[model samples]
Structure formats: structure tokens, C-alpha cells
Target: MTTPNQVFEHHELLYVNSNNQPVYEDAMPGVPGIDVQPLFLDPHNGVWVLKVWFHPGVILPRHFHTGAVHMFTISGHWEYVEYPNDPQTDGCYLYEPGGSIHQFMTPETNTKPTETLMVVHGANINFDDDGNYVGILDASEIMVMLDNLIQERGLEPANYITPPQPDHNTKVRNLK
Candidate 1:
């Protein structure tokens, strides 16, 4: 029979109250009117989850995703420059497969900022209007950016969740 002690051993769950977390204004340097609240970050697997707010008239640079991305629109509206007719509004969920490329923008006519919860894997390769490579955004990059922003703005540290380090014998299995 299995011992009681072995059966009772369990991992602790991580919980985050987003309201208690600090939002970084102008989170992306040079990108005004954008705010971000990091929820979770797993640098080892290049995964990050964020609550992002985009003010009206904001236009993100064109980018290509090297991994799939899932986004849920919580408020307001926004659309991809390549698909103006397919605007993502409140309560909308969008799934973009890896290799997808698009430019994000919020209409100037919007009365309020658009908010979305995004779960991203891998990196976003950004490009300028002329298609010139600009930079890459990933979990590791975000960690650095967020850290710097916190220090520069003199804000409290963010309360984002991160996985615990694995032991030497730990092995991650690919379910797929």
C-alpha cells in the first residue's frame, strides 16, 4: 500500500490578484498610451501572460509571431491593419497560430482604451513600415523591460507568477 505521507505530498498553487498588481504606463518604450500588467512569466519556455491596455490612436508595429498567441478582449475595440473589417471587440477571443503576422491598431474614434488579456509563446519579431527588422519581444526581454520600467518609474515591484525551478531529475514532457 502507498504510504500516507507520500499520498499527501502536493504542490502548492500560485494565485494572483491582478487588481493588486501595478500597471506599467507606457510599458513599451517609445510606444505611448500603452499600459501593461504582467500576470505570469515562464522564461524557460518563453511564455508570458499580460493584461494590456491600448489607448485610442495607438498603432503597434507590424510583427510576426514565432509561436501561437491567444488573446481575449475585455473592453473596447481594436483590429489588425490587415483585417480592418474583423475588429476584436469586448468579450472576443482570438487565437493566432504560430507564423502569423499582423499590425495592431486602435481606432482614433474610440472613446476609451482597449483592454486585452494575452497569453503568448515564443517571440514577436517586429518590423517598421518599410519592413525593416526592428526588434524582438519575448518573455526574457519583457522581464528586463519591466524591471527597468519599475526602477525608472519608482513603482512597486509587479506581482507576477513564475514557475519554480526544477530539480536535476525533473523532466518536462511534451503532451503534444
Candidate 2:
């Protein structure tokens, strides 16, 4: 069973965009200060929901996430970067995707502001070895690419792919 209601459980059909009015607005990328928006894509439990917004030395550059990415900071203090070959330290610390590194950061100040509301079940993204498809980060090399993407994907019952707090909120009010 794929789980999300057993892989969407057939199709009696509900409603995709029946005036939900948003196929995708800020589909995440204009860059200036960083704001990702892809409100929903459930299509019967495939799962897509995203809403990340950052501003404050924004460096969500070194990308990664083809699938299974989940996060939730929702208010300030989300530096969360990685990549410590250790050069006097300072990359990022609380990113928490299997322990850190699927690249996304925001925290400038509206009182130390940064927000992350995520649920990514896509897959096959591993950008940034400086090949430069789109790895243009500054803040400590985006924390060594967020500590090399959480030490190249760490997991051992330690929130395997960042799963510690669920149900902080869930309101998904009909997204298109």
C-alpha cells in the first residue's frame, strides 16, 4: 500500500480545480528574496503541498528533492544548512531532511523570520557540486550544501527524512 489513502484509492472523482482557482501562482521562483508557492497537487494522494518563504540573506540555492521531502518551521530561526568540511564553521543547522540538506532557507528579520510548510513526494534532484545548473548560493556555500545534504541522506530512526512533528496544523482547504 502506498498509503496516502492507499495510493489515492481509485477515482470516483472529487474536484481538482472546480473554481478552486489556483493551478499554480508563484510556483516557487522569482528569487529576489525567495518565496515558493505550490499550494497543492494531491491528485488522489500523490501529495505536493508547498509554501516556503524566506527573506534574510536568502540562500535556498543548492537544490535537491525529487521526492520525499518534508518540513515545517513556520516561524523564524530556520537557518538549517549543512556542509562541514569545517572551514571555521557556519553553514546551517536546523534544516532537518533526514537530518539536513534538501536546501531551503529563510530568516532575515520580521523578527527573525523564516517559514517552511512542506510535503514533497517528488524525486530525483541532487544539484550543486558547482556544476552550476543552479547552485548559486552564498551563505557558507549554503552550508556546504546543507552539510552535503544531510550527510548524503542520513536516517536510522532519527526522523528518517525529517519526520518528527506532524499535525502542527493541517488545513488544506481545496487547492488546485
Candidate 3:
């Protein structure tokens, strides 16, 4: 018989109260009008979950994800440059496979900012017009950068954004 202590000890779970999370302004440096609130990050596994806000009329330059990305629009709307006609409005969901390149923007026509929840498995490789490797937004790297930003700005780090404990372990749950 399984002991009481083992009944619910198989998996590592995390809950994020976005309302309590700190909204970092211009989280992606050089990317204007963009803010981010990290929900969860597994640096060792290159996984990240974040809430991103894009101000109206804001545009994200061309870039590609090194891993699959799942995005769910929480408010407002946005569209890719390649298919501006097809917009992802609030409540919509999107799954972009790794290696797909695209640029997104919140059209000036949008009356409010766009907010989305994104779960990514790897880094975002940003490229220049000449197709040169310009920069990367890896989850692990972002964590370090954000830590520094918080220290430099004299802001407290959000609990959810903190690194995982050394003893933390993950296990799969069987829903039978």
C-alpha cells in the first residue's frame, strides 16, 4: 500500500498568479513597447512560460524560434507580417513550429495593447536583414539578464521568476 506521504508526491507543480507578478517594462531591450512577466522557466531544459505585452503599433523584428512555441492571446490582437490579413485576436491560440521565421506587430489600428501567454521550449534566434546571427533570447540567458536588470534597477525579483531549488525534481503524472 502507498503511504500518505507518497500519494501526491510524484510531480513538481507550479502555480503563477500573474496579477501578483512584476511587469518588467521593455523586457526585451531594443524591442520598444514590449513588456514581459515570467511565469516559469526550466533553465536546464530550456523551457519557459511568459506573459508578454505588446503596446499598440509595436512591431517585433524578424526572428525564429529554435523550438516550438505555443501562444494564446489574452487581450487585443496581433498579426504576422507575412500574413497580415490573418490576425490572431483575443482568445485565439497559435502554435508555431521550430525553425519558422516570422515577425509580428500590433497594428496602429489596435486601440489597446496586446497581451499573450507564450510557452516556448528553446531560444529565439533573431537575425539581421543580411541574415547574420544578431542575437538570441534564450530562456536561461533571459533569466540572468533579468536578474541583473532587477538588481541594477533596485527592484525585487518576482517569486515565480526565481530559479528552481537544487532539490526540485519533476515526474510524470498518470491520469487514469
Candidate 4:
């Protein structure tokens, strides 16, 4: 009669408090004034959850997702080139299907920066105007990039920012 939620006293739950996560400034290269906080990252599975902050007037290059992407806007406003009819403002939720191509930007009219929580399942492939391949970005690639940046700055990489290590000691608990 043990359920997935049942755990022994020695087991620690997989929980990450929003306040406990460290925020990194200028996380995306070539994109100044953008901040990122890793909410969850599974390098092995190529999935990730991140809290991204976009300064007003920031515009990202056109890109397409290999897998679906879910985003929840916490503050400010933003829009996509492809989804011009649906702009995501504060308290808005957006789900972009795989292979959807668009340019993301925080409207210049926005007085405040935009903050969003995003769960991405696959790589974001950048493309040129002529549809030429440029680059790919995924959870694994982002982790490696961040790690390298930390190393170059002489700062220790926070391993916990990545996926939580599997606990081998977990055992099914039966409460009858």
C-alpha cells in the first residue's frame, strides 16, 4: 500500500524554494541586461525550468523550439513576432508548440522589465533571415555555458543549480 508520495524519514523531498535560488545577471551572451535564475534543469533529459528577466526594449533573435515551451509571465509585458495577436502581459500564460518560430521581445513601451517563468523541453534553434542554421540552445548547453562562465570568473559552479542527484536510499514506505 505504498504510494509515490510515501517516503522514509531519511528521505528529502524534491523542493526548490523560489527565494533560495541564486539569480545570475547577463546570463545570455550578446543579450545584455537579461537575468536568469535556474528553477530546474535536467541535463540528461534536455529539459529545464527557468525564471527569466528581460529588460525593457530587449529583443531576442528569431528562434524555433524543437519541443513545446510553456511560459508564465509574472510581470511587465512581452510579445512574439509570430503571435502578434496574442501578447503576453503580467499574469499571462503561453504555450508554444514545437517547431514554432518567432522573435521574442519586451515592448519598448514597457516601463518595467518583464519577468517570466518558463519550462522548456527541447532545444531552441536560431535561424537567419534566409532560414539558414545558426545555433542551438538547450538545457545541457546552457548549463555548460553557465559553468564555463563561472569558471572563467573564478567562481565555483553551484552543482545544485542542475538536476537533483538521485537518492539511492529511497525505499517504498507502507502506512497501514
* Predicted model with the maximum lDDT: 1
Look at candidate 2 and tell me the lDDT of residue 61: 59
What is the Å distance of residue 170 in model 2 from its true position? 40
Superposition TM-score, candidate 4 onto the true structure: 0.81
Candidate 1 matches the true fold with a TM-score of 0.89
Clashes per candidate (backbone, < 3 Å): 0, 15, 0, 0
lDDT of 4: 0.82
Q: How far is candidate 1 from the true structure (C-alpha RMSD, Å)?
A: 4.8
Candidate 1, residues 45-127, lDDT tens digits: the string is 88999999999999999999999999999999999999999999999999999999999999999999999999999999999
Q: How are the candidates ranked when ordered by lDDT, highest leading?
A: 1, 3, 4, 2
- Give the per-residue lDDT digits (tens) of candidate 4, residues 1-176: 87676344545566677686667778788778788887678877778888899998888878989999999999999998777788898899999899888999888788878999999999899976688887888988888777877877776444344655566758575558
Error of 2 at 173 (Å): 42
C-alpha TM-score for every candidate: 0.89, 0.25, 0.83, 0.81
lDDT of 3 at 86: 87
Off by over 4 Å in 1: 1-11, 170-176
What does candidate 3's lDDT look like per residue over 75-110, in tens digits?
A: 999999899788999899999999989888899888
Which one wins by TM-score: 1 or 4? 1
